[model samples]
Target: MMTFDPLGDGISRVEHLDHMGDDLRVVNAARISFDRESHLECDDTGQWLQDQDEKLIGFLAENEHVSPFFHPQICLRITMPSFLAHQWWRSTVGVSRSEVYRRYVVAEPQCYQPPHWRLRAQQPKAGSGTGELGAERQAALSVEVERLYRDIRTLYGQMIQEGVAPELAQAVLPQATYTRWIETGSLHYFVRACGLHTGPMAQRELRLYAEAVSEIVGGLFPVSWKALTRHTAA
Candidate 1:
């Protein structure tokens, strides 16, 4: 029995499959139950586990193309920053994002780990990379960034301890700090707005998020994803 941990990835779980049409509706509903019960502590844990195993097998039993459900839409939760979120929000095609509010629900800020390749000589103003840096340079930059991150976290904790409101304290946090949002959109809208036609840099983070969404949707609506990808690429 190979148990899988969904939370290990930034993507936790996907639940909406009404977007994959009636043919997949029954199995998608079953999957929702399976996912929920699997996470819950049922008294008959063995039976619950067995049920999920059977449901998974059944879900994979059929291999027929079906019309994709376009109206209901799918929602994805993504962790990114205000700036990236701003960039993502620019696409007017069917995408909607609800982000963490600075006005409420404040906590210690989250952040992104920059790829190690960005530290060399600041690169061209246009931000193109020449090549990788040596180990010595990488190591030095890593140490400095880690130290700064640690210090910021420490200061954040101290401010909280000293009775600063989390919203106010978060002012000290960098724009690089992580934020999260729930993005919802139709498959056509999502794929078109986030497709390869978009500039590589403009779409980077959202593209990764879109890819994850595509994986889930593609699993249920393979033909639709393929069509959408083709259209976008074309």
Candidate 2:
């Protein structure tokens, strides 16, 4: 499983639940053109098979043959804040997911507490910035955020005690509320997701998630992962 503590809370993780296909699988899928198949365990050719597979992957990437790349599928169990999940779910093409349903289950609320508040960017469209705040101001903001979380949770629990439905009670929760989901998709889709979410100006939280998952993917399929990033970066 792949895991990351993007918020430094260690509460969030992206678990590599299960996956299918690999570098050789992509090569075999493409080799259908020549009515040939690559035997991954066939080391009788020494490094010849490995070298050929890497070259073939590069060729596939260069020529825009994405179908072969789609052969490798990855399934991830992602636990993240609701806001990041919303942005991730927006990259829907070639991706599929199912999320935890709060309508049926009632659980204690968990939240994302940022290490510190980021100041609003001078350019409003730039989002937040690392502008420093006084110790007093920072401490006050931290305390206020924690107080607000407690207040919201208390109200939510009171509603539940009063016989309110979970789905209705959960409406009071903020974007920082933690959520979980299982996402399964092709390698190409993940490459695309990484390309978007891990870019220079991507949301910081989502970028961390993307980078962690890409690390796992790269370790598992080095050659294909390299080919994918090279092609996408082009």
Candidate 3:
């Protein structure tokens, strides 16, 4: 599970890419209110990331009809694999991610909250849908998940006692293992990337996260956010 923190100082400026010709003074005010600096250091590496973000924003502004919005930084707490994290990093979006390290942070038995909508079909080969399991079934699945989680943790401890390397034993960890990260980015890229991953009736956890970001950005830049939301929803 990821946690969120308020954006701090010197990092609250909002960048706008709009062709609407409206002054958007109201939106600008909101941006000023929502802006915050990320905790990450602004070293050479950080400067490079910021440069890339500016380049992308400039490109979109010059070429695309849709306006874009970006805060100086974004904070995201996400739990995903190193592999997936690498993919996200490639976007060159101005977002920062912080994750737990196996070397520095001790591994704990992983727990995952089952999606409420997955009840009707515990294993949807085609993927999640609106159909969900009944209350009775959901309760049963919850018990099973808890039971399995405890069992897995116990086994992991036993493996350690038997001299298994932590890294090797970690391989048995399930994908559902919860992880957290903090990501920061331009609203333009954030919305675009999220739109690509989401479909109707997205998983509640991810959808809620996306929606929260959307709401934040939308409140800051109403016109641009509205257009983006309408386009994505359509």
The candidates, ranked best first by TM-score, are 2, 1, 3
Compose the digit string of candidate 3's lDDT tens values, residues 124-165: 543555577888888898888778878888887788779787
Which consecutive 10 residues in model 2 have the weakest lDDT in total?
A: 40-49
lDDT of 2 by residue, 1-234 (tens): 667666678798888888897788899999999999887645555533467778999998878899998888898888999988888887787778998999987888899987776777787755767685778998998899999999999998899999999988999999999999889998888888988887756778888888888987777777888988988751
Q: Estimate each model's TM-score.
A: 0.61, 0.92, 0.56
Which segments of model 2 are wrong by more than 4 Å?
Answer: 41-49
Q: What is the Cα-based lDDT of residue 130 in candidate 2?
A: 66
Supply every candidate's count of residue pairs whose N, Cα or C atoms clash at under 3 angstroms.
Answer: 2, 0, 17
TM-score result, candidate 2: 0.92
| lDDT score at residue 119, model 3, on the 0-100 scale | 35
Higher-TM-score candidate among 1 and 3? 1
Q: How much lDDT does each candidate structure score? A: 0.54, 0.84, 0.49
Instruction: Rank all candidate structures by their lDDT, best first, as comma-separated numbers.
Output: 2, 1, 3
Q: Give the alpha carbon lDDT tens digit for every residue of 17-52 in model 1.
A: 234242234334445645643232257443122445
Model 2, residue pairs in steric clash: none
